[model samples]
Target: MGAATTVAQNMSLCDKYTTALLKDNNATNQYTLMILLVNTAVIGNYTTTPAPKNAVPGILANGTFDGKAVNLLPYFDGSLLSSNRGGSSGVSVNFLDGGGAEPLKKNLPANDKNSHQYTLLTHLYEFFGVLLQCSEYNKNPAFPAYAGHDMESAHRFMDLSPSEVGYFIQQVGLSAASFGVSQEDVTAVGNSLNKLFGYRCSPPTVVVPEQGETLNSICQNEMCPLDEKARCDLYPNNGTVVEPARVNGTGNSTGNGTGMGMPNATASGTPGFSGAANRMGEGVISLLGALAFVVAL
Candidate 1:
């Protein structure tokens, strides 16, 4: 029962940590968070819960997965290029200086037909891999809590595999060839994935002494003061260490009325630490300022 309770508490802590990790911008932090999750799955005892076949149906149903919802193709389609002057076209080519008319406005066949599908599939594949690894971790007995649940269920939902994951990565390259996300964004995501899966723990650095050496030490040849001897008289046979009282100054007193010498105010500028009202006021002010600036501009 104690083990079960500890596992439950750890699981809750892991959930909170994971949420915070997702919100972080650092790839290392995200990878560390994932690693923590994997470690927890490996070490903790978990109760298995049934999951639906379609792990990301919400993404599909909400149109986030396909072009219908998020329209990721637009971000990657190189043929749909926009110029500094706001001119739009599929591809730019400089023709010979002959009098021949410029070629009719057209889209790059490579970009329009093949690239989009490849890019979408690639994103899907990578996302699926992370999910699959999570499932595998859940299945391992090193973590007893997740034993009953099938991590493979996520695959049935997403319909992806290792081969597909590679194919999708290739597709991302093709997509990048067309729609140009800043190279930095692409690199960041790639680096994050690499680090998340690649990290290894180093061996322990410290060794502990034997129990007898640690437990048998009592009072050695240390000299004691008369006042200390008097205090020891209060609890002669007790095993607990008694801390001596402070002999000088206004012991432990703070000058502030609140005792910590700090203002009892919220960071949000409200009177109470729970500054819900102050936040609402700040939000309203920001909204109004934005509206006014837009109107003025």
Candidate 2:
């Protein structure tokens, strides 16, 4: 689609998203966070500046599709990212600096504190993953020995498309798209957005009993029940009764809840290494995957 069309469509979608979020009491919370983050980008309020009261550092979700370990923070720390505050909306975007001079954060210098960063979308996904503790089973610190999960899988959950990206750019009032722009760049942005806030689900990795199965007898598999009605921590015959995890701080643990929780001591990652390495694989790819669009297109 042409730039104008893309912008119009995304603005419409954003409008729909906003209306639904405001009107619907049960909108998914993670998606709400995603929408807000996108809106923040559109309005030019980058998450953090080079100064004080910087946003808290969050854990990276998982490894990239290419198997690179990512230590992501919420803001563009100037090391991996270079920002331009000149879009039509005057919002700032943290673009990946491929030719950055400093290495990734390994005993770095002052100048290298926050360089070589992931794109804005990547930061959001990492924050979401950390917020939800997606790597752990049922948000229990006891599960998922690794700190990070598969980010690629999270991207699939987001299920972003090029059309969506087009809308997003327009909604945010981005620069005009010139000739020869490829679809992959937009697709990649959508992918990053998906990881950040998409809620698409694939088949269950664990084998919980079907709906007809007795909730009392379903604990042997170590998987939590997907059926909201079936997942009772107080059921008589099962092992330790666990409450379903809550999303978006609603105090209810069931399907469609936003599941936005705070990071705790349970989060994976070394003291200096950020959170555990994100292992979400190729399907999700890297949030910075769209950098090619910025660089080559």
Candidate 3:
């Protein structure tokens, strides 16, 4: 089976573990958000590998999150790779890192201004939108409150789920495999996420809220207090708070609030998400072309 399928299969186990973790009243909502955020980072890394040729030099190397550089591979033009070398002839796509340096560029464009095959940032944006939705749902007060406060509407920020997150990570792995990213590099990301969140890697036994834990209460007590720095570290412009609502058991709300199963609550129009998928598709096509070229040679 494909890696994506394998990961999807494993998602059930992850859900189970997560459910257990959240069952404890002491298990803060931040923990769940942290899992979501860290997973996004790992998955986004997979979607765009070796950093884009055109991306700002040393940007990924620096490992900084300035809202402009972190998780932004899909939006970059492949031509930038050639420009770094002075021209198309100067660029070379070489797999396998060695010589105490990064790999040679084999798939960069010939010019610095041409349209890129894929844009990684786009995927991140869409991913962030999904997260926002989740955040919003957690915070909505019209639902039962988790902590003492009304729901914060922050859960709506996340549009993607843990399973979908796993799928994206696997997709990135497939992309990186095309470029010859080392098994160590790919596995390192996965290990990092698992460690960061204490992830269980098992499917959840219960997808619904725990007993006495209203969705709104979970959002307020468990989810909202999570660190904004953690979210921003994964996707730029993420973690920003929207409006708040009440946690009255009825689920009526006002003003762009996010609730469970709400329309567009985690909709897929975020620029980053769409852009990443588009760029990855381009990379896949490019890889196929390269394979054909090698056969012709």
Candidate 4:
């Protein structure tokens, strides 16, 4: 793509997200709105349900959450190889004694922005109309339109039980919700994922606390992402609230409906998150800082 096209693609999708975000004047509320949307999806119970509260302990005990050790189940669909999903790009992990949950990555750059191959962030970004060229996405002429990039294909091999599908959505949804996505968007994403699973997890129940656990306490204690800085609150947010920008009109990218206004939420929250002051401002700084810090590895 030419420079102008690239710029337009970047800004067009960004406008969709920022337009969605700046709708809320208070930066914190923006984050809250995001979670509400996400909440509807992971636990939407649109099709399947319960997510087995008793199962969480076993998964946690097995050190399977947050890519601690590879489950090699839900990914590697379509043309994608094990490396595309797993830390397969020469990635090295160092585990402390009983530290499977927090294994340290030794990969130089787990994700490369300049590369055409869609790494994690890049692949996720395209969901919001970024139009990145993914080496693993739709490379084969025989691959389907969204092929390796689609959630259904990714999880198809797993043949996940309804509960496993619910758990998968919950984990991914909670990860995005932490950044400030809403339940509507989260549900949109979840609905899309559920379709891949034949609505097996429709009407899914989000992973709630066993008994004594509260929302705050469950996430505060149980969530595990690569970023240690991720927290229970609208994270990567500015310390103070800021006035919402007067963004107007709608944002459409790549001439497809698959732009920022996606049905269920997934990657629309990446607006201005690269630590660039020219974008969404300071709210994204800390999150980007954490991301950059990981890149330093």
Top model by TM-score, which number?
Answer: 4
**Model 4 lDDT, full chain set:** 0.23
Model 2 TM-score, all chains together: 0.20
Arrange candidates by lDDT, descending: 2, 3, 4, 1
Per-residue lDDT of model 2, residues 242-270, tens digit only: 22211233221121111212122111231
* Candidates' RMSD to native: 29.0, 21.2, 22.3, 22.0
Residue-wise C-alpha lDDT for candidate 3, range 224-258, written one tens digit per residue? 23432233322213333222222334222231112
Q: Which runs in model 3 stand beyond 4 Å of their true positions?
A: 1-156, 197-297
List model 4 lDDT by residue over 15-60, tens digit each. 3333444442232332232222222222221111212111111111
- lDDT (0 to 1) per candidate: 0.21, 0.25, 0.24, 0.23
Q: TM-score for candidate 3, please give it.
A: 0.21
| Candidate 1: segments with Cα more than 4 A from true spot | 1-152, 156-163, 195-297
Let me know the TM-score candidate 1 reaches against the reference structure. 0.17
Better of 1 and 2 by TM-score: 2
- Which prediction has the highest lDDT against the true structure? 2
For residue 247, give model 1's deviation from the true position in Å.
Answer: 85
